[model samples]
Target chain A: DVKVTQSSRYLVKRTGEKVFLECVQDMDHENMFWYRQDPGLGLRLIYFSYDVKMKEKGDIPEGYSVSREKKERFSLILESASTNQTSMYLCAARRMMNTEAFFGQGTRLTVV
Target chain B: GIQVEQSPPDLILQEGANSTLRCNFSDSVNNLQWFHQNPWGQLINLFYIPSGTKQNGRLSATTVATERYSLLYISSSQTTDSGVYFCAGRNQAGTALIFGKGTTLSVSS
Candidate 1:
């Protein structure tokens, strides 16, 4: 079975503070993604990493960045947390050419 | 970029009833899948049907790539099945799955 794990299930941060959310997968997938889910707006991509040291911005990457230092781990960083950034963040990992992806439980970040 | 749209944004059903959820995309896709997000926010993959149909237990999914749409059917619905159903697709390489807003299903005893 594929397993994706997030470092934290919930987090609270003050405005302008830096926040980091970590995600790890045990399946050795090459692709990892970060997305934020909000009411009515659904899930919007924040960033994604295809390989170690390689990352790409998604639809909503303006306030976020990502890093992939190893094949199994990906991290999402909010340079400066803002109140509007409070939302449920999800981390997903998948094989390079596979259609199926595994997701972590999610990190509900509350920016105060 | 591809756009995905799910039908019947919200659905309420009684136990033992059946229902079908629809997903429509704006562009051709290399792959498509259906996922059930449980009440606890865990996403369970239902099917990876780019085309044709596939079934698992009480659930079945049909995807018509040519028409850019997919359908997921739940039989003899149970309260445990109450959750949100999402359809996602890959339209471009090196891009993540573009997901539909989803269909929220609520099952009552």
Candidate 2:
């Protein structure tokens, strides 16, 4: 089974603070993604990486950035946390193209 | 990118009843998948069907790529089977899966 693990299950941060959410996958997938899920909006991609040090902006890539320094690790960074950024963040990984992506449990972020 | 739409945004069913979930995409796709998000918010993949049909346990899924639609069937449903069902599709040349809003299933005994 593919295991995707998040560094935190729940997090609360104050406004203007920096937030870092980490994700690690045991499957060594080549593609990793970051998405924020909201009610009625579904899951909107924030950023994705096809290989180490290579990143692409998804549909909703404002105030959010990602890092993929290694094949097994991906990180989501919130430049300046705000109330609008509070939402459930999900991390997923896929082997290459057209493969079923496995997701982590998710990180519920609350910005106050 | 593909536009994926799922039918019956919300569904309510009785235990032992069966239900079918539908997903429609706007364009050609190379990959399609079905997922179940439990009450606790854990997303689990049910099927990875680009086309044709695949069955696992009491659940089965069929994706007709030519028609740009997919169907998920749950037979003899249980209370524990209630949650959100999402269908995602990747365009013919794309790698990321564009997901539908999802259908929330509620099962009562």
Candidate 3:
């Protein structure tokens, strides 16, 4: 079975603090993505990494960046946490040419 | 660019009722799938129907690639079926799946 695991299930960070959201996948998938879910905005992509050390911005990439140091790991960084940035973060992994994708449980980030 | 749209932003169904959710993709996103987001925020995969029909228990899905649309049918809904339903698919680039706004469902017992 494919598994995508996020480092924290829930996180609370002070405003202006730098936050790190980690995602790791057991499957050796080449595509990893970070998305944020809000009440009515649905899920908006933050970043996508097609391969190690390669990344691309998505629909809502402001105030956020991503790093792909290894094939199994993708990290999302909040340069400065803000209340408006508080949302549910999800990580997903998919094969390069396949359409089936799997996601992690998600990390709920709250900035105060 | 690709766009995924869903109908009935919110739905309320009584137990044993039936419902159908629709998903439409603007581009040629032949690869389509449906997911159920549980209360705990975990996305549970429901069906991956590129084209054609598939059934599982009381749930079933049909995707028409040429028409760029898909439908999910729920039969005899239960309280446990209360949750958000999402449909996603990949564009021609095979990039990550573009998701729809999702249909929020509330099933009452």
Candidate 4:
């Protein structure tokens, strides 16, 4: 079974604070992604990494950045958290040629 | 980027009932998947049908790439099946999946 693990399940931060969400996968997948889920918007992609040191901006990449220094780990960074940034963040990983993606339990972020 | 849409934004059913969900995409796709997001917000992959039919237990899915659409069927629904169902598609660009708004399913005993 493939396992995708997020570093935190819940987080709270004050406005203008820096925040980091970490994800790790044990399956050695080549693609990793970050998405934010909202009530009516469904899941919108924030960022994705196809390989170590490679990153691409997704539909809603504003106010967020990503790091992929290693193949097994991907990190999402918020330059300065704002209340509007609060959301359910999800991390997923998939093999290069595989169509199915394995996701981690999401992190519910709260910005006050 | 491909546009994905799901039908019946919400659904309610009783135990042992059956339901079918549909997903329509705007362009040709290289990958398509169905996901069930449980109440606790854990996403479980139900199907990876780029263009074919697959089944598991009481659940099944069919995708027609030529038609740019897919369908998910759930039979004998149970209370534990209550949650959100999402269908996503990946276009020829090989980008991440573009998700639909999802169908919220409520099953009552």
Considering every candidate listed, which one attains the maximal DockQ? 2
Tell me how each candidate scores on DockQ against the true complex. Answer: 0.65, 0.80, 0.71, 0.78
Segments of candidate 4 deviating more than 4 angstroms:
none
User: Candidates' lDDT values, in order?
Assistant: 0.89, 0.92, 0.92, 0.93
lDDT of 1 by residue, A1-112 (tens): 5799999988999999999899999988888999889889988889988888999899999888888889999999999999999999999988875567778998989988
lDDT of 3 by residue, B1-109 (tens): 6889998889999999999999999988855889999998988889989899999999999998999999999999999999999999988875677899999999998
Per-residue accuracy of model 4 over A38-66 as CA lDDT, tens digit each:
98778999998999999999989999999
Across B2-74, the per-residue lDDT of candidate 4 in tens digits comes to: 8899998999999999999999999988769999998779899999899889999999999999999999999
The parts of candidate 1 lying over 4 Å away from their true place are none
Per-residue lDDT of B38 in model 4: 84
lDDT at position A73, candidate 4: 98
Candidate ordering by DockQ (highest first): 2, 4, 3, 1
Task: Name the weakest run of 10 consecutive residues (lDDT summed) in model 4 chain A.
Answer: A94-103
B103: Cα error in model 1, Å: 0.4
Q: Looking at model 1 chain A, report the run of 10 residues with the lowest lDDT sum.
A: A94-103
CAPRI class assigned to model 4: medium
User: Worst lDDT window (10 residues) for model 4 chain B?
Assistant: B89-98
What TM-score fits each model?
0.97, 0.98, 0.96, 0.98
Deviation in Å, model 1, residue A52 alpha carbon: 0.5
